[model samples]
Target: MTEGIRSGTAVGSFWAEEERCGGRAVALPSWLLTTSNEEVAATVARLYGGQSRSRDRQQDLFELTLDNDAIAVNVDGPEAVVNRLVLQQVEEHAPIHVCDGFNFLQPMDNAGDPCGCPESVFDRKAAARSGRGPKPDARLAFRLAAAPDLVIFHLTSSTWEFSDSLSAAVAGMERGDNGAQMTISLQRKAVTTRSGMAVSYVRPILSVIQQEFAAPGQLRLAA
Candidate 1:
């Protein structure tokens, strides 16, 4: 390992990084669901396979890592069962921002997308600071060849109760239960870069999702 750092040798992730302030940054840790490395690998490869092979095939596959314990659940797709199953288990819900994890989401160099979508929490933070609320990346959703392929549903609960049933609704519900959808902000991000599209999951996302569904828990400031 270089510099005595293991630099995690995962096929689709980055080495854990720390910011200038010594705060940890961009750690593409995965809390794998029923989704197997094989399934993720297969889906990603299939999505990007037909395209002319490039030296860097990495960009096509997205990497979302949740704090191992934070993920209450995760479901994999055969592209048959439905991607909604995957959303059911998610607990991490940080907003994307440019300064945070979503540095990849800036104006694209090409006409692929006129506006840059968020890639990570940093991108969400930058957008939040601006007048705009949570905006999901359209291209990311559209790029996938599904009619209802990658829909992101935002669910907000009044009493702060997060139940598996609630997750089921978030993934599959077309309408919110009692303005619960109105309470939470939802956004979708499609990562496209030279290295291939990639997205990392952080704890803040979980916090927001939790806030939307459940009462505020103990507040712990980052060191």
Candidate 2:
């Protein structure tokens, strides 16, 4: 019965389903942690001490209402965050074209050959905004500073500004030791286009709080 289930030949996956929080299910974009999972709601309550209200979209979803827009987080390392360029037909499905702004990570042509993409980040952003290329697919994983031992939370965004600043953010994280402290927040900004049309939007922001350092005696001992 287990003949085809050998250690190396097994084809099943044991990955746990990740609990997510975002503003997609809400009528208006906000910083509140909105999720449909009970586990996520409980975690948010324990950490942030907020009451949840049922918000109906196509179905019932809970919004974890908190007072603050920013939350302190502890990241394992720079690897916990990633940003990529992706193009897909639907929001819920996997992307057809995936790239890193310089090269294609997945083949876009029927011949199994990688297709050409914009050589510069600016050009890539323009193409994506114009619906001719891939857009940013940014993901982050971290634990709340208040409950560092609790469950890890994941957040995803498609904001171009967040994607553009990822390189610098990762570089800052690299300079810090393991389990770096940071703050994740939502920032709203308004700008006028060249045609004098004003637009307002909110984008996610991540900033380093403090870097851990070795004790002076420990450093001397190591030296």
Score every model by TM-score: 0.17, 0.67
Model 2 lDDT per residue over 125-203, tens place = 7888777898877666666777765555566567776565554555655665454677777677789999999987667
Which stretches of candidate 1 lie above 4 Å from their native place? 1-23, 27-37, 49-223
Q: How many residue pairs clash in each candidate?
A: 30, 0
lDDT, model 2: 0.57
For residue 191, give model 1's deviation from the true position in Å: 20
Best candidate per lDDT, number?
2
Candidate 1, 100-123: lDDT as tens digits: 122223223432332344545466
Q: Would you list the C-alpha lDDT of every candidate in the order shown? A: 0.25, 0.57
Candidate 1, RMSD to the unseen true structure: 18.8
